[model samples]
Target chain A: MTDATATRPSIAGEQRIDGSDLLGDVEFLVARVRAIGSGHAREALAPFGLRVRAYAVLSLACGSVSPTQRDIADFLQLDPSQVVAVIDSLEASGFVRRAQHPRDRRVNIVEATEQGLATYAEAREAVSRARDRSLGSLSAEERETLTSLLLKVAF
Target chain B: MTDATATRPSIAGEQRIDGSDLLGDVEFLVARVRAIGSGHAREALAPFGLRVRAYAVLSLACGSVSPTQRDIADFLQLDPSQVVAVIDSLEASGFVRRAQHPRDRRVNIVEATEQGLATYAEAREAVSRARDRSLGSLSAEERETLTSLLLKVAF
Candidate 1:
């Protein structure tokens, strides 16, 4: 007997249909991509003892500007409470240091330590490489189109 | 004195430029979108006392056939430890119940309670509307393009 699951008949006088059309839904596809990327990053960062969020916080704090907690949270689109934990972890690891703001006592100015910056630099490269591998299948032009479309949606 | 900050060009231009150059970087964009969506969902689900992860877990449990803890984690790309806390909270809130799997003694089959399903149904609609409002600025065709491009990147 023919494998019913493996064989599907095409419409009369029409081109054959692969499962691609049925398999393709933009949202679902993106969701799967994201899931895969997140998993990869989590594993990649684990050895360095950094969560993705902590690495991002460090990346944003690498510049000379001593960003406030609110600034970091806003840029990262994270809650103030959530930011506290990420900061705490970094601070505990001595990767980041929090200072009292001169003008605003309520605001905590955060900066990446030398250790933090070094770790961030390496982690960023690793992340970039991992991403490159994930998008390796797509052409450069297709990649550009995908990024532009995401920005268009986000902005 | 001229405001020192006044001459500091806005990051909006930088954002656009980065968007153009970094279009093919799907992993980077995925992280940003997840951060943004998590923040937005957090605000909307606040009244219902649900974090985005929690809501997703409950929703999956409600809809899935024989969803185990591993299944939810795999679907959401969340860490097993994180999934445990999320499930623990849902179980505590009486929104979900965990049972030993009939076939696999090692697995716990998670299912949403009536209250959980009801809550999820309402939140799902609200979340959809919130996403619509968030993307309202885009043209219908743009949204389609955005979704399609994201799928291509993801798949």
Candidate 2:
């Protein structure tokens, strides 16, 4: 058999010239990690019929506040049309429903059904496991610090 | 006048229940940071006739190694077809060209032209400025720490 691994081009190897080049860039690193994490999440969520985007919408809906479509769009940084499509899919599956916001009647709220909550709880566990596996190289403290740093830049 | 900012639903406000939740998840944080960074990069690269994805491909092409389409796809975690499209656009714009890989006759390498290199140099500076502005809230030390942590996870 050919040495398959030997022939594989390593990104780190290719980009490690000065150790402070494009690969070390914050935006590039964030995109890389997100891509890897999303890949794992996508596979883990497949059994639940959820993609990352839909799962994000579902997760937000399962939160304490009932989010409107606009809320989901704004929070997720997704377009309103994209949020609507995800919500439509979730609504079709009976995982979520559109209800009037008690405090704001003009806004339609995305509320999770009991089934949705149950599904989300299970999906959350799967996603968490996948995320942890992806970050297995980092310790708990490192992960905590990474999260804090990311929040500072992200928000 | 309408208070447009007030009408916007804040992502932080929507998810600040216990100070830690799904929004605080590492994967979610990575995704959020990537989104924000990409938004900034998109605006900065627009004048250069590049989007974030194309810029990534260009950056890789401008690197020390003459990367193959497969290498670009693998390193960038983009689909091969997507990389092909980006390369096509870059090629058409005269920023890049397909050349024969000396070591591997079967592989076509994506190499930057003189014009491409010059354009990439300018684009890199613009992107760096945009990245720095987006990360202005963080101290230089914090940014360095974040970059180190991200490199560990990303690679």
Candidate 3:
């Protein structure tokens, strides 16, 4: 078996190993870790019939008050057209509804259904657990610092 | 302009500014960021006759001795099939060559050409600059932590 398959079991194992000091590139390391965490979350959310992006759209819409499709796209850093596709999938699945914007007929307001909110809450918990597993090796201080650092990079 | 156009600049700017804090959902953030960053990188590399993934493949093949396509995918957290596409593009571009594995007939060994190495060096510098701009707000300590956290998440 390759190293990838061999190490799959210990992906979230409780180990305080430091590979950062050895690798000089921070962005590359961040990219790798993010992929792994995403893969885990993807697997967890799969059972709930939610792709990662779909969950993000639903989560953002849950907190939004009659947000247009564009608003969700902006918040999620997705393309306007991509938002339409996500909305199409969600709307078809009966997880979301599109109503004409009160002020602008050109815009479509998107809101999550009751079912969507319930699904979001459940997926949120699953994702949180997955995150906990991913961050299992880090100290509390490390997690805080890590979150802070990622915010700095992103914002 | 629509709210979509109105929000574009601020949204893009904020994406750069609060990258770390917005990483509340680790996997989602990583995937989104990677998609965005790689998209940008792909655009920039297009005129140079390269794709972002092709550049990464070249860099790996040149740096490592007798690396397999599987090795490249494993190191980069990419699917092997995806790696095949990347290598295919590189091979078609004449930046890489795939030879029969002397010891393992089932494996294909990839190597970078002279032209590939030169282009890779140039692309690496460009990508580094882009990453620097993308993470400009982050302190050295934050960058370190972000890299470490991302690596942990990936694993």
Candidate 4:
């Protein structure tokens, strides 16, 4: 079945009949690209038994510092309950564990296990490949520019 | 309560300890900024009884072309069922209506009601202001660059 081609803008300026109005909107563009990228990452990480969110948690855990659940929630912009759930799943898979903070006994820090690091190494490669494929249209310079611009808004 | 400072990078060059590793990852940055921007839009759009996704739908509906349900789904990268649900809500709220396509009887096009267009105009202003607030850190030129880069990836 033929889909609606009415929405596609023509170069000749022949009375545009489409949702091209949304094309210039930053939020819409961001959400669209993110959804597409996330879908690709999810598919790529599926063989590793990891979703994008879980992979994000694992990636953060592989960082230099052992992040607490609260830190994960804040950095990932996830709810505390959601962070707890991802951590719980990661712990069950032996990817991460909650331990008492080195300086603060009252708090728990999430640290990656050896297996977790190894798994992350593989998953990171897969995720990177997936990202590269998703952003294959852009040049290296464009990608770098995109990243730098995103950081200004993101952080 | 003192949150875990472990994840915060030290400024003294004493070995940066944080998820700085994921900072360069485009997908992560996109997700982060999108989350922050969406949150701001959500709050600003609340008074109009719209969320980001719904606002997107309404914005599309307000465009020059009356988009079909399939068109909306394809353009938004949303599930057809989800589009149907959103359309149902908007239709019930008198914001939009499903009409038989002038060119194709079998196709139903989604068009904004007068109320929908009026509401959309106000919501667009709110959403734009919210986006400006969320992206306050960037210069106007940077915002344009960000939007252009996002469009390249999104389209």
Docking class of 3: acceptable
DockQ score of the complex predicted as candidate 4: 0.48
TM-score of each: 0.60, 0.87, 0.79, 0.89
Per-residue lDDT over B83-154 for candidate 1, one digit per residue giving the tens place of the 0 to 100 score: 899999999989999987664577777878999989888877666665666566677787677666665555
Q: Taking candidate 1, what TM-score does its chain B reach relative to the real chain B?
A: 0.78
- Give per-residue lDDT, candidate 4, residue B43: 99
Which RMSD does model 3 reach against the true structure? 6.8
Which candidate achieves the best lDDT against the true structure? 4
- Classified by CAPRI criteria, candidate 1 counts as incorrect
Query: Interface RMSD values for the candidates, listed in order?
Result: 8.8, 4.7, 7.9, 4.4
lDDT values, one for every candidate: 0.67, 0.82, 0.68, 0.83
lDDT per residue, candidate 2, A1-155, as tens digits? 25554665433443322222566689998988998999999999999999888888888888877777887777777888898899999999889999875556666778899999999999999999998988988989999999898888777
**What is the C-alpha lDDT profile of model 3 across A29-88, one tens digit per residue?**
656676667777888789889887787777766763546676677667787999999889
Which candidate has the highest DockQ of all?
4
Pitting candidate 3 against candidate 4, the one with the higher DockQ is: 4
Comparing candidate 1 with candidate 2, which one achieves the higher lDDT? 2
lDDT of 4 by residue, B4-106 (tens): 5445532222233467568999999999988888989999989988878888888878887777777788888888999989999899889999987654576
TM-score of chain A of each: 0.79, 0.86, 0.81, 0.88
Clashes of 1: 1
| Candidate 1 residue runs with Cα over 4 Å from true position | A1-128, B1-25, B148-155
Clashing pairs in 1: A143-B24
Query: For residues A1-155, what per-residue lDDT tens digits would candidate 1 score against the true structure?
Result: 35442332212222222222212323334556777787677777887898777877776667546566776776666789999999999999988999876655776778788998898778877777777777776787777766776666555
Residue B154 lDDT, candidate 2, scale 0-100: 81
